[model samples]
Target: MGKPYRECPHCGAHLDAGERCDCGEPEQQEQTAAEERPRMRLIAVCREVDKDTGRIAVICL
Candidate 1:
């Protein structure tokens, strides 16, 4: 299951893939001003590596 989505906490509008809410709400002023957001990192995984050579199925997201 995925996390339940909710309306925008700032202006009660809605949030997409954007940082700011739909409206020009500044409710997150304290949060943004007080702390800094970190960039998301993608990690890959190797399913199986070749025994003879050096090959693997690197899965990425």
Candidate 2:
């Protein structure tokens, strides 16, 4: 089965999974914050906020 998914930075409106936002985005854009994620916690989606600095959080699989 496919994995449960989250929204694309371009696609997700209310923060849900999708390939592209209805408003549209550039192809150069990468996957959503979730897809780029290495993994999610077993129970919950990790909450992270980055204002500046190096990669804030580079998810390592």
Candidate 3:
């Protein structure tokens, strides 16, 4: 009935036979790279101070 199509492994886009998908393109690579890295946020900071020596320690979560 209809022409056969295949799914792109990288982006899951349906492509016609012999067609190329843009998932491996430079812009897509940059986007994927950004997505793969872990993102962190500074929730809180805690400080401990010694009474006699006046030494301080910092803890972050």
The candidate scoring highest on TM-score is 3
Ranking by TM-score, best first?
A: 3, 1, 2
The 10-residue segment of model 3 with minimum total lDDT is 40-49
Model 2 weakest lDDT span, ten residues long: 52-61
Q: Is candidate 1 or candidate 3 better by lDDT?
A: 3
Clashes of each: 0, 6, 0
- For candidate 2, lDDT tens digit of each residue in 1-61? 8556655565455534554455575444555755787884564443465767433444543
Best by lDDT: 3
Residues 1-61, model 3: lDDT tens digits: 9758999999999999999998787897788999999997886565888889987766857
Question: Against the hidden true structure, what lDDT does model 3 obtain?
Answer: 0.84
The lDDT per prediction is: 0.68, 0.53, 0.84
Better of 2 and 3 by TM-score: 3
* Model 2 TM-score on a 0 to 1 scale: 0.18
lDDT of 3 at 35: 94
